[model samples]
Target: MKTKAVRMYGTDDLRLEEFELPQIKEDEILVKIMSDSICMSTYKLVKQGKKHKRAPQNMDTNPVIVGHECSGLIVEVGNKWKDHFRPGQKFSLQPALNYMGKLDSPGYSYEFCGGACTYCIMPNEVMELGCLLDYTGESFFEASLGEPMSCIIGGFHANYHTNKRNYDHAMGTKTDGNILIMGGCGPMGLGAVSYGLQFENKPKRIVVTDISDERIARAKEVISEETALERGIQLLYVNTAKMKDPISELMAITGGHGYDDVFVYVPVKEVAEMGDKLLAFDGCMNFFAGPSDSQFQAEINLYNCHYTSTHIMGTTGGNTDDLVEANQLSAKGAIEAAVMVTHIGGIDSIAEATKNLPSIPGGKKLTYTQFDMPLTAIGDFEELGKTDPLFQKLSESCKAHKGLWNGEAEKILFHHFGINPKEL
Candidate 1:
């Protein structure tokens, strides 16, 4: 079978090309990728190329496709997995396949198995390690976003607080406790806000801080204060850039008690240090951002670490369990994965969209593998509609849903492109 995918040659080198795919073995599977959401991790991978730990070293010779947060339908299921998986089944996968203690993963290391493609092959290890997942969500974008949602979920689970009496550690954030998310306007940070609000052990209050008023305002509009209050949780959005004393103002929200759970979403030194200072006694801080620099360092107060029992930890990607939980929540409409997506493009736009992801303002850049369009933001759909009928339909659908992308918009896009989801 012939498949079109974006392949990496070296640092900052990616090309979209069509090639013939090798036949799937009895233990393998073939998938038709429908939707793939561009990740900042993919941008980092492009910057480092083979230098990245998860990327293959021989990329100059054997290029690998570059996308991981993806979802689609099973085109063919090999005999070995015929009983468990069948053709025409919608699916996604846990890309962080820590198999055999190796850093290798799909999108970074695989030649025939990645997300930014029309069709791809799934190697044996994917199913063997239980990373291949079946998705029954209404939108393929939701399934594609499940991977990132899992990472957020993992960060929450990785946080731990110790008990003074038994010296025991309690997993996850404290129930009915104050929570703070630094640099919380980004897609992942906003996702943390949504998840934190709907979490089983819901926090009493969540304070989201960011430097940009535009982003903070958008976050509030998407997940409104009324919405948070309906769930019995208090949500506050703060723009620290305007404050004369940001720390004092932030701490005042918690009555100077400080936050029980603090998550640093930006890799900036100041953000990390600020999160360290905001930690309450026995507070657990999670560094959720992946820094591009290998020697990235941040200062933490040892006094608080030793005396107050405050500590910090970092996590990369989520495990299979976290992925499963994310999928379940998204499938049930408990969380809005669409909030992460701000732009939509086709497979042709992935190379530029990924290479310049940081410069591209807004949230997730969602790509449809089979379409052919430039990277266009959901906000610009109405403007683009003046020149393009396709954008006009998209603008109508998005406007109907409060300027956010939804499944109806997705179906409209697919139909406009003459691609039938049922056929795929």
Candidate 2:
């Protein structure tokens, strides 16, 4: 069956083109993708164009589907598929598979699963192994983010207790004390902070770092759900641009003993090592962001590991459990999906957004598959008539006298005051 997908011809040359999507077999189900967000890791992949290197610079022999985080309701199920799933029910996929569990999984070598795509024709062997599940009132976007979340949950469950690479012991009621989060401006980084801030037995402080001063300023003001400030939830917002020695400052803030857990949300090797320095004795450091290139590696002081018992671990391409926990966490208020998504656009804008994501100011820009126009306002704020503050700020930044992401030059003036989408 033919379906529309944002096919990538090469770097920054994505197209909204129609292609034949594979049909579901008796054990497979069909889902029309409703919403998908471009995660930062996927953003780097799209910009690199490593999917099919042999393909021409601006052309493709095969169409590439363009998202990994997505949500949709089931529309069709064959007889065999019907027993485990039903039509019209909300569902999100746990996209990767542990090949040892699945004979139908796409590869025989190292780990292999399709990258981010609008929709997937996943194999039944992966599903029956119990990675994907039905959504239970969690926000569809939250459900889409499950895979990433699962890794965080799985990280905690890992034999880190027995992991002797770094810290041999951990001290906390629940979490690894004080977490330093790099790249707090983006969705994945913020999600890690949210987990650190809200999860039971969490750290004493969450120091969020990003190069963009504007994004960090906003995060300091609006990035939490809890009431008490002393719940190990200190927001150490810093200006990385001004720092000649950021690691020293990070260490000073944590009392030189360092954080119990430092989550390196970006792929920069230096940042990962800095997190290692911020560790207390026998501390654990997590590499949450997958580097765009395979050659990316961080150099940690092995002596620290030998004497202090510091542990270094990295994770990528989330598992099935990530989605389930992410969904439940969102429902339980650990995550606020509405606030996390700052921009909404359609297919064409998604093409542009996919190209410009790393450089953009907002956290995440999502596209609704059913919509035609890009950048439609999802909230009830009436379009500003004469002038609006946000619009005014945006206009000065855009300097075109039209709305942000305008293709047809439709000048949409946003409101200075209005109802929020989350309030409803």
Candidate 3:
């Protein structure tokens, strides 16, 4: 089969090319990618090229497709797993397959098994590791979002609090405790906030901090304080840029008791240090951001670590269990995955979008693999609608959902673009 994909040749080298895909082996399955959410990890991979642990060398000759957080329909099932998976079934996968302790993974090391293409082959290791998941969600975008959400859930699960009695360590965040999300208004941060609010052991209070007023405002509008109140959780969004003393002001919100769990969403040294100061007694600070710099350093309070049990940890990709939990939570409507999406485009836009993802101001940049369109933000639809009727209809659909992307807008996009989902 021939597939069109954005392949990475080297550092800052990406090409939109059409190539023939090798026939799938009996242990491999073919998937027609429907939607893929661009991630910053892809940008890092592009910048590092072969230096990235998951990325392969010799990319000039053997390039790998970009994009990992993706969802689609099963086009052809290999005979080896025909009983477990069938054609036309919705699917998503945990990209961080630590199979046999190998660092290789789809979207980084695979030539034909990445999410950026119209169709890609799933190797046997994916199914063997049980990373291939059956998605029951109504929309493919939500399924695409499940991967990132799984990362957020994994961070929450990685947090640990210590018990003084037996010197035991407790897994997961402290239940019904004060939680602080530092730099929590961006795409992944918003997902963290939404998941924290809807999690089974929901925190009693959530304090979100961001330097950008615009992001804080948009986040509040999406997951309003009223909605959080209905769930019996106290939610607060603070623009640290406006505060005279951010530490004092944030501490006041927790009644000077400090936070039980603090998540640092930014990789900046200052943000990490700020999170360190905000931790309560036995507080667990999770550095959730992935920094591009290998020399990135942040100073922590070792005094508190030795005296008060304050600790810090960091996690990267989520495991299979976290991905399954993310799928279940999203399917049940407990978490609004749409909150992370702000822009949508087609497979043609992947190279540019993934290359400049950090500069783009918004949440997730969703791409429809079969379509050919420029990257457009949901908020810009109303303005772009003046000259284009397609944007006009999409603007109406998004406005109906409070300036957010939805499945209805997705269908409208496909229909207007003359790409039929049924045919894919």
**C-alpha RMSD values across all candidates:** 0.9, 7.4, 1.1
Ranking by TM-score: 1, 3, 2
Model 1: lDDT equals 0.92
Consecutive 10-residue window with the lowest summed lDDT within model 3: 415-424
Q: Write the per-residue lDDT of candidate 2 for residues 1-424, one digit (tens) a residue.
A: 6566676655666777665666678876666565566666556646666453322333355445666566666767767877788877777766555556432222111111122333445456656767547887534556655655665555544414324566454432225466677776666666566566666665667777888887776565456424326564666777776788887887888788687666677778777777777777767777777776778877788998888877777666556666677788776766544435566565557677777777776666665554453553323122431355544444453334112222111123212223121220
TM-score of each: 0.99, 0.76, 0.98
lDDT against the true structure, per candidate, is 0.92, 0.58, 0.91
Estimate the overall C-alpha local distance difference test score of candidate 3. Answer: 0.91
The TM-score, computed over Cα atoms with residue i paired to residue i, of candidate 2 is 0.76
Give the per-residue lDDT of model 1 (tens digit) for 1-424.
9999999999999999999999999999999999999999999999997789888878899999999999999999899999999889999889998889998889999989899999999998999999999898889999999999999999988888897899788899999999999999899998999899888878999999999989988898888888999999999999999999998999999999999999999999999999999999999889999899999998999998999999999988999999999999999989887878899999999999999999999999999999788998999999989999989999999888877899999999998899988675
Q: Using lDDT as the measure, which candidate wins?
A: 1
**Which parts of model 3 are misplaced by more than 4 Å?**
none
lDDT of 3 by residue, 161-188 (tens): 9877997788888888999999899999
The count of backbone overlaps in candidate 2 is 16
Rank the candidate models, highest lDDT first. Answer: 1, 3, 2
Worst ten in a row by lDDT for model 1: 415-424
TM-score of model 1 relative to the true fold?
0.99
Q: Pick by TM-score: which candidate is best? A: 1
